[model samples]
Every structure is written in C-alpha cells, then in structure tokens.
Target: MFAGCIDIGGTFTDLILYERGKGLEIMKSPTTPGEFERGFMDVLALAAKSRGLSLGDFLVKLELLVHGTTVSTNALVEGKVAAAGLLCNAGHPDILTLREAPRKRAFLTKIDYPEPYIPRKFTCEVRGRIDAMGNEIEPLVEADVVAAAKHLKTCNVAAVAVSLLWSIVNPKHELRVREILQEELPGIPVTLSHELNPVPREYRRTISTAINASLYPIVGAYVSKLDQALRAAGYKNELLIANCVGGMMPPDEIIARPIYSVMSGPTLAPIAAMQLTTDPNVIVVDMGGTTFDVSALRDRQLVITPEATFGMDMLGIPKIDVRSVGAGGGSIAWVDAGGLIKVGPQSAAAKPGPACYGKGGTEATVTDANVVLGIIDPDYFLGGQMKLDRAKAETAVERFAKKVRLGTVEAAYAIYTTSNHNMIGAVEDITVNEGIDPRDSYLVSGGGATACHIGEMAQILGIKRFMIPRFAAGLSAYGGLISDVRWEEAATLHETHVDFAVERTNALIDRLRARGRAFLDRAGFPRARQRFEYAYQGRYLYQSWDIEVPFTLPGDRLTEADVPRLAAAFHQMHERIYTIKDENDVVEFTTWKVRAVGDTGGADRRGVDLPKQQGAPSPKSRRKVYLGPKQGFLEIPVYQGDGLGSGARIDGPAIIEEPTTTILLLRGQSAVTDAHRNYLVELAG
Candidate 1:
C-alpha cells in the first residue's frame, strides 16, 4: 500500500510518496495558479511513472492522500472570491461596514479599509432578536427571512452568511435563517457564525463566517473536482486536506470552513520539524522562492498566532504564529535612491523566475547572486534536469554594481548578506521579542534557499549548531506524512474562580468531545486510538488580556478540587514569565478548548537514515568561487551531496551540491553529516 502528501506553495508544488521498505520518493513541479488542480494531477502522474506502474495501477494500491492547498489563500490575496451577502439581526446590517479602528490608542478617520465583503445593498436585516442570556426577546418572523433570501438571490449573490445577536449563546434563529436561505437559493452555500466560530466577540466570528461562505463556490468546486478525479483513477482512500488549525480535515469540513486554510501551507514546515526531530523545542525556518517564514515549537505545540491581519486585510482565523519577511531565493536586489544597496520585499516568482533561469527576469535576486558568485553551478542546477545561465546572472548583478560603484562579485556578496540579515531580524522578532532566548532553541531549516544561508543566519545570532534535511525543498510535504487527523473546539464560560460552575463546564466539555469524536469515528479511527487534550484561557481580575493554561483531565470529569490546583498552576505560569503573580488577585476563565487527534497507527516511519547507506565523501569537480571580497577567489572543490557518508566532516570554503539544494560553507565553518543523512553546521571556536 502507498500513502503520500502534496503541498501547493506560491512557486512550487511538492510531492512526497511513502511506501513500506521503499522509503520516501520526493518531486517538485512549478505551481500553475491558473489551474492548481492541473499541477497536482501532473505530479501524481510523475509519481506513477517513477515506480514503473501505470497511473491506474499505482492509484489502485494507494490507501490515502494528504494535501495542503493554497486555494483560499490565493483567492483572498488576489481579490477573486465570490460575491457574498450578509443576513444579521434587524438594524445591525452596518456592523461590517463600520470596521475596527486602527490598533492605536485613538481612532483615526484617514485610514482606509478594504471594500467590505458585503455591500450595504447586499446586506439585509431579518425580524429576529435574541438577548445575551439566550432568551428570545421577539419571535422569528418567517416572512422576513423569506423576503431577505429572495432579495439576496435576485442580487445574484453566490453565498450568504447568517449572523444574529446572541447567536453564539442560542443559534436557533441562525439555524432557521440557514434553512430559509437553502429554501430560497437551493444551491447557494450558507455559513452560520455559531457553526464556524462560536464566541462572544461578534466581529471576528462574523468575518470568519463571511470569508468561508464567500470562497465556497471557488474552493469547494476545486475540491470536488479533485475528489472526483481520484476516484476515477481507481483509487479508494481517505483524501485529507490541511487546515490553518494545525491539522488535516476531510473534504466536507474544508468546504464548510475554508477560512481555516488561509496560512495552512506555511504552518506545515513547523509540523515537519516537530516530527523529524527528537528535541522538544525547535525553530523552523522556510525560505521558498517568494517568502521566508519563521515558526517555533516550545513543547511540540505551534505557538498561537495572535488574531490579526491576513493578506493585508483585517481578518481573523485560528492560525499558527508564522513570522514572515520578503527575503527568499528570488528576492530582488537593487541600488537604493540614497546610492546604497538593498535586497527585497519584492520577489520574482515562478513565471518570470530568477534572472539565472533565463526567464526574462532582469532584476538581480538572491538566486542570481549565488549564480554570479559561482556557488550555484549553472550546468548542475536541479541535478542537471534544468540548466541556468551564468551570463544572465552576472549581467543582472553588473547593472546594480554599476549604479552602486562596485564590481559584480562585491554586489552579489552585498545582496546575499542583506537577505541573510533580513531573515535574522525576522527570527529575532519571534524569539527575543517574545522573552525567549534563541540560543536555547535548536534550529531546523527548510525550503530550497535555506541550505545556502541558514548556517550564517544562525552563527550571526551566536547560535552554535543547525541542521538541514536532505529533502529540504519539500519539507512541508514530508511533514504531512507524519501528521494525524486533528480537530479543535472552543467554548466561552466567562466565570470567576470563586463563582464558577464546575458541572456546567464539565457538560460543555462533554459536548465538544462528542462533536470531535464523531468525525474521527467516521474517518475509521477506533476509540482506542483517539486522544483529546484540554486547555483553558484565563486572565487576572479586571485585566484586558488572557493566557492559556493546560491541564490533564482527571478521568473525563473536572472536579471541585481541581479548581484550586488549576489556579495555582496559572499563577506559577504567570510568575515564570512575568516575574510576578498575585495570589489574591481573582482569576477568571474566558474560554475552554479541546484538541482531539485521531491516530492512524501508521507504517514504520521512525527510521533515521536512507536505505542506500551514506558512502565516503567524493568530490565531483572544482569551481572558482568568490569566497568573499576579503579572500578574493579560491579554486575549491564541490562534492556530490548523495556521495557523502555519515560522520563525514568537510571544512569551510567548500560546497555540497544536491538535486534540490546547495550548501556553502564559508571560511572558519565546518559541515558534518549526521547518521540521519542530514547536515549539521558548526562554527569554529
């Protein structure tokens, strides 16, 4: 049997296929945004050919396919989503039009907000009112719902989102509104706030629902088309999709809550680090063609991304905190207006690629800089599957060098260093700014460009060691190989420690667990393999913010004695981070969360090294590389990456060339191959 993972990135589509005893087979293809599903099918075809099996025969033996897609991401960023209408309580249609003020202390009128998802003409008010305590102040008027749905249908709205007052407390009216919408517009998708994100804050929940509903026609269609193709290919398996909440879900769940997939692709690299390494704490850096992202795992849990902006738009979804800087392999390098040199916040993506690719990209990018410096071989690029033009790279850098009064080699060095520093600053924001010392963390670098710069980035920050996997280009896809099916749910209790209701809290948790397990059972996981974790979001009395405290459930029930233990645990956590905690300050709970993971009890995937034992280091050939302006130039040898044996240590001023990546070790640095066929970079004392 076979299982695989596919990740669709901004520039590349990666595939990792795993079979027992045969190990992993990885491949990359250019991402075609015009038809993303076509790119996926193309990769699947390649995987079949590599195994010498026909497409139908290969899929016949496949049991599962896990996919991480950026469809919703591109839809939101490119402003290509479907037109949506909103149906809220009477007189509350203006809630979305009046967006939030700037996060500053005072409101500013000069700020500009993106065009609202639903215009005033498309928003309709229904005759229903529910109070904060789940009481129906005024009964629902069916005629009003019918009128609103009919009006929305006449407007040609593709989807509708139903959000009413106190809907999170009692969703009876919102549920009725959905039924009426289906009755009026039979095929149009409908989203209810309570079904998506049930919380007190209406604005965030409404935005989540609106975004999900708006993308249903687009993302939903693509998913359905892909599912149909898989079945037609003689495949019988579970097709799992990656969501923004750090887990994979079924096709039905994705269409219902597509907003959870906004930043899902970038989040997977961290998951790869979590499963690949034995360390409990690690930092994951992914440098792709267009962007570099930094994410951390303190105890194998993705650091919670605070609710904020998405694709320059004010949107909220449960996302992993992934800090990004526009420094990548294709980041453009140029001479600034002040007669200084600068690297990018701009990128030359796949279509026009980098200057070295001879794809009509005139700008000098980090990839171009590497080619100009002779670190990236023109003839051996991509294992000679594709060739690059060294002349084009030099010409692109020469233009910038002339404007900055420097030589081509000097200009290329500047571009490389500038991009590395840019990534360093991004790493600092996640580590130093968050009160965590970066030196205490192990670094794992992923993506194509990481091999060239991750070592230097870590060394500059006083870091001692870093590791890069052999298949760095497709690390996120490899992460999907080890990922399990996970689902999360949150409910608001808003209870003070002294007056909290333990029985009510227990009942709430029981409901959330049942809801989570139903899907796992449907997915074929037995009750023995299902596990759930419990956590609480708490705050000090009268405080504006809260912190999450995790606790183990004492057998399915939370007892009265557990309250004091929970209070003490919260205080200790607060004190450990903030240096002070008030025992007398009443603590309050805001939300309860449950995360359930259904284990697949998968294949034996714990091996460290490849089946082909690492052989002795063998040099392929030599190249004249510009080590630095200080050293001028050196005729150093380049080694074929696959020929290097484990425990083989190569000193600085050398290069290791692989099919998907390249590693450059500067003077005073060394590279060692671990037993796992990964490289560990160490700085000279």
Candidate 2:
C-alpha cells in the first residue's frame, strides 16, 4: 500500500511517499503563496517525477492522501476571510460588537483594538428565548427569523451563523434558525454554535461559530477543488485533512466544522514525533523558515489546550498545545529603536525569503547569519537547485554589524545565539511553566531548519538525548501517513452530580457515539475496525475552564459506585495540572465527547540494513565555522549525509550536511546514525 501526504508550509510544500515496502521518501517544492493548491500539487509532482512516474500513474497505487496546511490561519492573520453575518437573541444582538474589554496595551491609553470581523450592520436579531436551563421560555418567532435572513442576504453576506443562548441545553431554536437560513440563503453556509462547540460560555461559542461561518466557504471550496483534482488524478481514496486536535478527518467533516482546524499545521509537528518515537516524554521542534513551532508529547498523548486565543477572538475548542515563536531561519535580524538587537516576531516569511535565498530579499535573517557563519553551504542549499548568494548574505550581515559596532562574524554569531535563546525561552514556556521537567524529555528536531538549531536548544534546556529523523524536513507529511482516520462529536449537557440525570446523560452519550460511528461507516470503515472512545469535559464550581476526564464505560447508567471514583480521578488530574485539588468542591460535567477512530494499519520501519561495519564516518570536506563568542570560530570537518551510512559515528565538532537540513554537533557531543538513518546525539557524560 502507498500513502501519500503533503504538508503545505509557509516557505515550502513537503511531499512524502510512504511506499509500504520501500520505506518513506520526502521531497520539497517552493510554496506558491497566491494559489496554495498549485504548490501542493507541485510538490506531489516532484515526488513522482523523481521516481520516473507521472502523477496520475503514481497516485493510482496510493491508498490515501493526507494534507496539512496553514491556509485558514493565514486567512485570519491577513484579514482575508469572507464577510460573515450573525443572528442572535432579539433582546441582545451585539455579541460580535460587545467584545470583552482587554486593552491592546495594558495600563496605557491605546485604542488600536481591531474592529470585529462582523460589523454591527451585518448582525441582526431573532425572537427566541431559551433560558440557561435549555427551556423555551418564549417560542422562536418564524416571522422574526425570516426578517433576519432577509436582512443578511440584502447585506450580501457569504455565510450566516446562528448561536442561540443556552442552545447546548436544547438546540431546537438554533436548528430551526439554520433551516430558515437555508431556505432563504440557499447555498450560503450556515453555522450553529451548538453543533460546533456546545459549552457554557456564550461569548466563545458565538465567536467560534461566527469564525467557522466565515471560513466555511473559503476552506470548503479549497478542499472541494482539491478533492476533485485528486480524484481526476487517479487517487481512489478520500483526501483526509489534519485537524486542530492532532488527527486526520475527512475533508467534508472539516468543511462542516472549519473551526476544528484553526492551527492545523502547527499541530502536526508534535504528532509526527509521536508517530516516529515511542518515548512518552519528547519535545518536537519544527524550525521552518518563518517560525519555530514547539510542542510536547507527554505520556504518549499530544497535550491539548481547551482555550486558545487568536487575534482577540478566544476559541473554545480542544486543540494541540503548540507554542510558536518568531524564531526561524528567515526571522529578520534588526536593531530595535531602543538600540538593542532583536531577532523577530516579524519575519521575511517565504516569498523573498531569507537574504541568502538570493530571491531579492535585502533583510538580514537567521539564514543569512548561518551562511555567514559557514553553518550552511551556499552551493549545496536545496541540493544546489537554487544557489545562495554569499556576497548578498555578507552584505546583509555587514549592515547589522555596523549598527552593533561589531565584526561581521561577531554580528552573525549574535543573531544565531539570540534566535537560539528565544527558542529556548519558548520551549520553557510550554514545558517549565507547565511543571514538566525539561531534563526528563528528549528533543526530536523537525523541519528544514530544525536540525540546525536542535543541538544548542537541547543543550540549553538540559535535554540529554536528541534525535533528528532522516526525513525530518517533511516530518509532518510522514506523520500524516501514519495517522488514523478520526472523528469527534461533542454535546454540552451541563449539570453537576447533584442534578445528574443518568438515563438522559447515557442517551446523549449514545447519540454522539452513533453520529461518530455513522461518520466512520460513511467513510468506509468496517464495524470491526472501528472503536468508540469517550471523555467528559468538566470543571470545578465557578471555574471558567474545563479539563478532559477519560470516560470509562460502566454499563448504560451512572451507578453509585462510579461517582466517587470519577471524582477522585478528576481531583488527581486537577492536582497534577493545577497543583491544587479540592475534594470537597463540587465537580460538574460540562460536555460529553465521543471519538471514533478507524484503524489504518501502519508500521514503523526497522532501522535500515547496513553491512555491519565499525569506526567513524569520513568527512567529505573541511570549513571554518563560527561558534558562539565563547568558542569562537574554528575549522571543522563536514560530511555528506549520504556518505555516512547506517551505524555511522561522528564526534563533535562536526557538520552533517543533508540536502534539506544540516546537523551541527558542538564540542564533546557525538552523533551516531542508527540503522534507520536517524541521528541520535549523545551528550558528554
């Protein structure tokens, strides 16, 4: 079986061909910013062309195609999403306008807060009254709904979202609202908050639905177009898209709930590490051109956060917890107005890319610094397909060196170390701040730039073991191949144990599970190959956020025996996460989440078979490279990656150069390639 995967990154689109018997092969192509789908196809074509096969002929043997992209995230950041309309309660229609008041600048008179995506003019009201208990105090007036729909259509809204207060308790009014909008707007996408995220907080649910509505048309059209193109190209299976929670789902499911994939690209790095290594404690660092994405794999599970804020809009969805920093090869290096050197939260991004890319970028970036420091080979970058202009890089660094009053090499080293510490700080925020001991975890370097920085970052964080996969540059695409097809359905029925309705809760659980199973069945999963897992999203009394508690099935009802044990588990979990557990406090169940997973059989390859040999690998060449100010510049030996076969050992300071990435081992650190071509770096004991 063949599984094809593509990860559409900011600078490059990575393609992975996972041939069942032949292992995995990765290829990359520059991402076309305007028409992202073109870049997606371009990478796939390169992968096939390299193997002397046409795209159609290549895809015919594939079992599935999985893709991860930053399209939705880029759209939101650039304010390019389609116009949206919101329908809310008649008495209070300013849900989008009356946002929570948190100043753009704390304790300062800054009025730079952005306007809501949906203007007040585009927001209208409907006559409906559902109390907090989900009871219909006043019936939904059809006349008012029709008037709202007419107003939205007149405004030329691309999508309409309906979020009735307390809809989670009973979705009757919200469902009817969608029905009316469908009849009135025809093909226009409509989003219902209860169907998306049915939690207690009205603000998050409303915005989440509104955001979903805005993205539906854009994301849906992109997926549909890609699906059609793939089908025509001879791909016989469904095109699966990675989701917000670090799993693959049918693109149709993503279209229905676009909010579930808000930061889909960043989530895949950690998942890729999860699939490659069996270690329960690992940090996956994807250092691409524009950003450094850091995520942790703990206890064999992807750590997820319930609430994440994006551009002033708080999302109430469970998503992979990945911390991102503006620290990458393309992160611009500049002297701030305060006369201090800063790396970035701003980047040169992909287009003109880094100064060394020789694509007309004049700005000094981390990539330019690497070129100046001789950490990268200008002639060997991108397998020499695109040559790096060493003079351009030198000129870019010299400009910054003038500002800092330092030598060219000194300034370049400054940029490199500055960016390295910035990434270290970011990793600390996710691990140290969360009570995770950095020393207990290993680092798995990913992305095109990841291997370049992994050695230093791991050393600074006190991480002992570090490994970079041979196919690290396209790790996300490889992960997509090994992932399972998953579907999740959640419904809110907020009630404490005091008011717990066992039969009603069990019925709700079964309903969500059925929906999940039905979705899997439609996707062609056999009943035997499918299994349903359950969880309870809960929070303590008066708490704003909730935590997931694994649901253990106990017959069809909540027995008296289950309550204390469940409560104890919640207490233990809270203690572990928050460091505070109150056994006496009232614990409430907010939502019932049912997950359906279809097993797609996959096997991690055994280390490559190399003729058993001993002794260290030979260096292809020698070059002068600048370490930090402490070590200064030193002459180091560089080895071609392909020449160093499996079980090859090379001690520091040595440079292992691959077409896509380079691994730098400092003094005393030794790198040993395993049978699978994985570089496992060991620290000096």
Candidate 3:
C-alpha cells in the first residue's frame, strides 16, 4: 500500500507519495485560490500521471492520505468567515470589544485600539454567573439565552459562541446556555469556551472561541467537500487533516476545533526537518512561493508555544513554534513612496503569480529577480513543464528599476537582498532573541525557493553547515507521512513550591493523561506505542507573566518529594531564558499540560540511499549567472541533480538543477551529496 500527503499552501499545492520498500514521488501545482478543492485535485492528478496510473486506480492503492490545508487561515485573515454571535456573562459584553492594549504604546498620548475579530453588534450578554473555584454564584437565566438566540436568528448568525465568566471552572451555566440556544436556533453550531480553550484571560479565551465558532460553517463545508471529493475519487481510508500541534486529526476533529488548523501547513516543516537530519539542535527554513517559515528543534523535540496567535489575536492553544514572514518567490518588489526598493509582505499569490509565469502579472517579484539574475532557468522551470517568460520578467523588473533609478539587474539584486534581510530578521527573532545562537545550530533548507538562497542566508548568520533535502520543494507534505498521531490537553492550576499542592497536582495530571491516552486509543494507537510528556506553565512569585517549564515526575503521580526537583527545573529554565534565577524565591505553577504522541513507524526509519559513484559528475550544461556586482555574470556549470550519485561533489560557481528546485553555489562555496542524495553545502568562512 502507498501513503501520501498533500499540503495546500498559498501559492502551491505540494503532494508527496511514499511506498514502503519502494520510493517517493513528489509533485507541485499552482494553487487554485477560487476553490482550494480544485488545487487539491490538481496535485493528485499530477501525482497519478507521474505514477502512470489512472486517478481512481492510484487512489485505490493508497492506504493513507494526510492533508494540510489553509482554508481556515485564509478565511480568518480575509474576514470571509460566517456571521457568528458571541454570548458572554451579563455586564461583560465588551469582552470582545475591549481587547488588550499594546504594551509598547501604553504611555502614548493617544492610542488607536484595533477592532475585535467579531463586531460588537453581534455580542449578546446572557444572565449567568459562575464564580472562581467552580461555584455557581447566580443561576443561569434560560430566558436570556433564548431571547439572545432569537435575536441572533434574526441577525442570521450561522454560529454562536458562549463565554460566560469563570466557565473554565464551572461550565454548567455555559453548557446550559448552549442547550438553550440549540433549542431556540436549531442546527446552529455553538462553541463553549470551557470546551475550546479552558484557560484564563477572558479576552483571549472569548476571542479564540468566537473565532472557532465563526470558522465552524466555513471549515465544516471545506472539509466535507474535500472528503466527498476524495471518496468520489476512489479513496476509502480515513482522511487525516494536519493540525497546528504537529499532528493529524480526523475530519470531524478538525471541524470541531477548526482553530487548530490555522497554521497547520507551516507547523509540519519542523517535523520534516527533524527527520531529515540526526542533529539534536536544528533550524528549519522553508521559503515557499508566498511565505518564509522558520522553526527550530532542541534536543530533537519540537518547541511548542502555550499561546500562539493565528493572525492578530491570541489562538489560546498549544502550537508548534513556527514563525513566518511574507518573503518568498512570489513576494512583490516595488519602490515605496520614499523611493526605496521594498520586497513583500504582499505576494502575487497563485492566480496572477510572478510576472515570469506569464499569467498577466506586471509587478516584479522575487521570482522575477531570480529570473533576471539567471539564477532560475526560464525554459527549464518545472522541468520545462511550465515555461517562464524571460522577456516578461525583464520587462517587469524594468518597470520597478525606473522608479528606483537603477539598472534592471541592480534593481533585481536589491529586491533579492531586501527579501533575504526580511527572512534573516524572522530567523533571528526565533533564534537570537530566544538566546539560541543560529551559528551553533544546524540548518535544513526546504520549500522550493530555499535552496537558491540557503547558502547566502547561512553565510550571513555565520552558520557553517546546512543541507537541502532531495525533495525539498515538498518538505511540508513529506512531513505528514512521518508525523505521529499527537494531541495536547491542558488545564489551569494554582500551586506553589512552598505549598506544594501534591494531591491536587496529581489529580490534574492524572485527568490530563487519561484524556490524552483516550484520544490516542481512539485513533487506533496501542498503549505500547503511546508516549506522554508533562509540562507546567509557571512564573516566579509576584511575576506578571508566566513561562512554560517542562518537567518529569518520579512516578505517574506527583508527591511532596518531587517539589525541590521540580523547582530546580523551573529555576534552570528561567536562568536559561532570562539569565537569572533565584532558588530561594517561590516558583508558582499556573497551568498543567500533557502531550501524547502515537508512534507511526516512519519518523525513525531512514530512506534508501542511492549507490555511490567514484568520480565527480559532469555538468549537463552551462549558464551565465550573476554572482554579484563585482563578479558580474559568470558562465557557471549547471548539472542535473537527479543524474548525480551519492558522494558526488560540485565546486563553487555552479548550479545543481532539479525538476522542482535549483541549488546555487557561489564563489568560495561547494556542495557534496550524502548517501540519501541530499546536498550538504559547506559555507566558506
């Protein structure tokens, strides 16, 4: 049986198919933005064609298919979501409106507050109260809920959100409200805060629930359509959707918690990166057609954020720490009003794509820059399947060059350099700012555009070593194959080392572990293949904010004996992050977390390597490529990457051309192939 994964990105839909004991086949197609389902089908068709099988026949031979989509993300960012109403406790109607202010602008003379995800008019206050410590302070008024439901029905809301005060502690009132709303507005989906986030911070919780509720109709229809399409195409197995926590969830789970699918595609890059190399501390850089994503792994473990934002608001869920910047092959190059050349945060996405695609785009993009500099072969793009227009690319660059008052080549170079700078800054934010030096970390480059700029970016950050996977263009899709079934469950706790609430902590962790295990069990993972990790989000006494500190107890339950050890772990982590720790000070634990993973039998397995060859390989062709202003354009040897065997070496001022990607070696740089045919580039110090 064959297993495959598909990732629908902003500019490209990547597909990777793997057959056990056979090999891997990868394909990429332009994304169909008007209907993402079409793009999904298009890539499957391409993969089917490559395998020389009918679409239905090929799908029937597959045992599994994992998908990572951007439908929820696109809907949230574009405000094209369903009309969802928010229901909160009486007198707290401003929970969504009075969002937290920017800390940097706290002392400003005037502050312009950002609008909430949901409009204030859609917010309805319900008569209910649940005080702290799981006590019902006031009885829930069912009349209020029914009235709100009728009002929302008149407003034509597709979904409703319930976020009463203290719902995380006592969810009876919230649950009752949901029941009442369902009776009043039949078939309308309702989201309860305690079930979605189940943590503190009202604004964050409410907004996250509201967002999830709003996305219900949109993501529900999307998943249903895709599932029906796959079933119609002759696939019979379960359809797993990638989630933000580096795991795949079933369609029903994703539709229930659509918020987890927001950054799902980018989250898989680190998973693929960790598998590509044995390095414990590694950084993965994925430069796709629309965004550059950076993620890091420490001790071969993913770094997950306790609270990550999807777009501008707090997601309030555990997420893999993948930072993304709008710098990619499709990033537009333009002259700003100040007469400065700026590369994008705005992309010529898939439709009009880069000007070189000859798709009616006139703006010069990063792809155009590479084309103008001869870094990308116009005729050989996509293995000559799709021809790029060199003249159109040059014309596009000339348009921007006139505004910047520089030659076409100079303008293109400026655009490329600026885009690289933006990518470097994003990498720094995740590494340097976190006290993890990029220089000491091994870099793995993925995505279609990464290989072209990895060497230069590595040199800029003083990184000595990096590798490009043989199938770098579809790395994220590849991740879905190796990724394990995973889920996270967390709950808020109030405990301190001084008091050491042992029984309470033990009870909380026990409940969390049970839930996590049940989740894996339901997903068909046996207990023998299940793994659980324990962590606590805490801070020093009197601190305003908290940090997550992972810890291990001596046994399944927490005891007073483990207090000193747990405190030490918190102190050590605190020192590592802030460069300061006070052992004497009390450490307070606020939230308890548990992560469960189900082994998939693919993560640790090594790929079959190609046979080694004795001598240096010959170049298939030569091209005039621009090295820089000083070196101008040099005739560089260009070799077909697939024709090169393992242990083959290519010297500086060369290009290794693959069907979907290109690797450029500048002056004083060289690359060697490993047993797996990966390009291991050694930067010149």
Candidate 4:
C-alpha cells in the first residue's frame, strides 16, 4: 500500500509519496493563485508520472492522503473573505467594534485603528439578556430575531454569526436566535459564540465567532470540491486537513470552524525538526518562496500560544508560536525613498515570481540577485527541469543598480545581505528576546530556499551547530505524513487555592477526559495507543491576566494535598516568565484543559539511512561566485550531493548540489555527511 502528503503554499505546492517498501519521493510545482486545486492536482500527476502509472491507478494504490493549504489565510490577508453579518445583544452590539487597547507603540500620538472584521453596518441587535451565573434575566424576543434575519437577508449576507452577551454562561438565547435565523434565511451558515469558544471573555468569544462564520463558506466550498475530486480519483478513505494547533483533522471537522486553518502548515516545521535531530532545543527556520518562518522546540516540547494575532485581530486558538518575516527566495528588492536599497517585506509570490523565472516579472528579487551573483546555477535549477534566465536577472537588478548609483554586481550583493539581515532579526525575536540563547540551540533548516542562506544566518547569530535534512525542501509535507492525531478539550472552572473544591474540579476534569477520549476513538485510535496531557490557565489573586501551567496530577483526581504542589509549580513558572514570584499570594485557576494524543504508527523509513562508506568526493565542476566587494569573484568547487556517501567531508568555499536544494559553504565553514546523508555544518570559532 501507499500514503501521501501535500502542502499548498503561497509560492509552490509540495507533495511527498511514501510506499511500503520503496520509501519516499518528493515533487514540487508552482502554485496557481486563483486555482489552488489545479496546483494540487498537478503535483499528484507528477507523483503518478514518477511511478509510471496512470493518475487514477496511482491514487487507488494510496491508503491515505493528508493536505495542508493556505487558502483561508490568503483570503483574510487580501480582504477577500465572505461578507458576513453579526447578530449581537441589543445593549452590547458594539462589542466587536470597541478596541481593547492600542497594539502599536504608546509614544505614537497618531495611529491607525484597525477596522473590525465585520463592519458595524452589518450588525443587527436583538433583545436578549443572560447573566454571569447561567441565568436568563430577560426573555429572548423571537420577533426581534426574525426582524434581524430579514434585514440580513436584504443585505444578501453569505453567513451569519450570533454572539450575545454572556452567551458562554447561558447559551439559550444564542441557540434560539440561530433557529429563528435558519427559518427566516434558509441555507445560510450560522456560528454560535458559545459553541465555538465557551470561555469567559466576551469580546474574544464574539470576534472569534465572527471570523469563523466569515471563513465558513469559502473554506467549506474549497474542501468540498477537493474531496469530490479525490473521491473521483479513487481515494477511499477520509481526507485529513492540517490544523494550526499542530495536528490534523478531517475536512468535516474543520470546514465548520476554518479559523483553525490560518497558520496550519508552518506549525508542523517544529515537529519535523524534532525528528531531524536528537537535540532537545532546536530552532527551526523555514525559508520558502514568499516567507521565512521561525519556530522552536524547547526541551523537545512545542510552545503553544493560547491566542495568536491574525492580521489585526487576535484569534482565541492554540497555535505554535511562529515568527514570520517577508524574507525569502522571491522577496522583491527595491530602492527606498531615502535612496537606499532594501530587501523585502513584499514578495513576488508564484504568479510572476522572480525575474530569473522568466514569468514576465520585472521586479528584482532575492532569487534574481543570487543568479546575478553566480551563487545559483541557472542550468541546474530544479535539476534542469526549469531553467533560470541569468541575463534577465542581470537586467532586473540593473534597474535598481542605476537608481542607487552602484554597479550591477554591487547592487545584487546588497540585496543578498539585506535579505539575510531581515531573517536574522526574526530569529532573534524568537530566541534572544525570549531569553533562550540561540548559541545553545541547534538551527535546523527547511523549505527549498533554506540551504542557500542558513549558513550565513547561523554565522550571524553565533550558532555553533546547524543541520540540513536530506529532504529539507519538503519538511512540512513530510511532517504531515508522520504526525500523530491530537485534540484538546477545555472547560471554565473558576477556583482558588484558598478553598479548593476538589470534587467539583475532579468532575470537570472527568467530563473533559470523556470528551477527549470520544474524539480519539472516532479518529480510530485504540485505548492502548492513546495518552493524555493536563494543564490549566491561572494567575495570582490580584493579577489581571493568566498564564498556562502544565501539571501532572495524582491519579485521575485532584486532592487537597496536591494544591500546594500546583501552587509551587505556578510560582516557579511566574518567576521564570516575569522574574518575580509571590508565594504569599493566592493562585486562582480559570480554565482547565486536557490534550489527547494518539500515535499513528506509520513512521517506518528504512530507505532514509545510507550504508556507511568512506572516501573524499571529487568536484563535478567549478564556478565563479561573488563573495563580497572586497574579494570580487572567486572560483568554487561544486559537488553532486547524491554521489557523496556517509562520513564524506567537504570544506569551503564549496557548493553541494542536491537534486532539490543546494548548500553553500563560506571560507571558514565545513560540512560532514552523517549516517543518514544529512549535512551537519561546523562553524569556525
């Protein structure tokens, strides 16, 4: 049998095919912007061609297929999401519009406030009231709900969201309103705040519902079409989609709440890095065509943020803390108004791509600059499947060179250095700013463009050790194939350590455990293959915000004696985060959570390791590359990566050309091939 994984990124679509005995094969195709499904089908066709089988025959042999897409995120970034209407409580209709506080700098006198996800003009208020204790203070007015539905119908809204005041406490009003809306506006999708996010915060719950409703129609139609196509191609099993919470879910489970798919593909990089090295502390950098994403695994554990910002709004969803910047292979380089060259916060994406691609793009990008400097071999790109136009690349860079009054080679060098600077800042934000030193962490490179710049990035950050996987180009897609099934369940339980209600908390945990177990069972995991993790969000008695504290409770219940242990853990964490601890203060717990994890057990890859061999590899050719202005162009040896065996060592300045990626070594850096044929770079002191 066989299994496969596909990831549709902004610039390329990557596919990885895994067979029982043949191991893995990866392929990539340029992403088709408005027709993402076309790019997806194209990759599958490539996989089929490689196997010398018809598309249908190839798909029929596969037992599983996992997908990751950027459709939902792209729609939100371009403001192309569906036009959705909001139904709010009469007195609190402005909850979505009111700003919590300015997110920008405090010293700025004038700042632009972000527009709400749903405009105020589309908001309709119905008479209803629910108190904090799950009590209905005022009766829900059905007539007003019907009137609001008619108003939304006249507006031709594609979807509707119901977010009433205190809906999490008493969802009766929200549920009733949904029924009336369904009856009046038939077939329109509706999202209830309580059903999606049953937490205490009013604005967070309300906005989360609005965003979900807005994404429902777009993501729903996309997955439906893809599912139908897969079925027609002879795929018999369920289609799994990657979620931003570092796991996968079926299309049916995620189509209703597509907000979880915003940053899906980037979350899997850390999981793949863990498998690439034995180091517990790893800094993963994914440099794709349009973006450079940085994520970390500390002590072999993923650091998940309860809330992450998308565009200008904060989403109340669990996400791996990934820091991204517009520094990639296709990042456009331009001269700023201050008469200085600057590399991107803007990208060429896939439609036009870089000038070297010969796709009608006129802008000079990072890839074009690399070509102009002779760093990238035009004839060897994509193993000669796609030839890069070096003359066009020089013409593109010359345009920027004239504006800056510099030579063409100097301008290209500037763009290269500027791009590296942007990527270095991103790594610092996730490492040094967070108190985790980069010098102690092993930097693992991913994406097609990673190997080109990682050595320079590592040198700049003072990192001593770095790793490049054998299949670094498609790390995220590979992660999807090996990832485990995971689901998290949470409940609101407000309690303090002073008079801890052991029984009540135990009951809440039991309910959460049941929910998690049911989900894992439905996902086809037996009890023996399943495990659970526990944690809670809490704060000091007088604190304004809460921090998540992971704990190990005794047995399946919490006793009075365990309260001090939990308190001590919270104090130590608080001191680590804020540099202070308060043992005298009471600890108040707000949200209890249980995360269920199931092993997939399909991680066998005997073909990945190479037989041990000894001998120095010879250079296939030599090319002149521009190192810097001081040392103009120098001849460097280039070796075919596939011909090199285990324990083979190569020193700088040299290039190792793999079929999918290329590695560059500077004057002081050297690389050695490990047992798995992965390159491990050694930096000079």
Report lDDT per candidate.
0.81, 0.82, 0.86, 0.85
Model 1 error, position 333 (Å): 2.9
Give the candidate order by descending lDDT.
3, 4, 2, 1
Report backbone clashes per prediction: 0, 2, 0, 0
Which of candidates 1 and 4 reaches a greater TM-score?
4
lDDT of 1 by residue, 443-509 (tens): 8989988888876787788777777887788888887777778788877777877887899999999
TM-score of 1: 0.93
Per-candidate TM-score against the hidden true structure: 0.93, 0.95, 0.96, 0.96
Superposing all C-alpha atoms, what RMSD in Å does each candidate have to the true structure?
A: 2.7, 2.2, 1.9, 1.8
Candidate 2: tens digits of C-alpha lDDT, residues 1-685:
5677788887888887777667777788998888888898887788778778999887787777889867787788788899999998987777666665532545656556667757889888888799887789999999988998898888999999888898988899999988888998899989989888877777778888888999988888888888888888778877889888767888888888887777787787886787668898898888887888889887776777876767676665778888888887889998888888899878887789888787889989998999999998999887677689999999999998999999999999889989999999988988898888888988888888877777888778888888888888887777777777777888887767666777787789889888998989988889888977777878898896789877677564566667677678788778878888988898898888888888766445322455543566778899988988777889999988867667888888889998788888988788888766778888866
Using alpha carbons, what is the TM-score of model 4? 0.96
Candidate 2, residue 131: how far the Cα is off, in Å = 1.8
RMSD (Cα, Å) of model 1: 2.7
Model 3 pairs whose backbones collide = none
* Model 2 worst lDDT run, 10 consecutive residues: 605-614
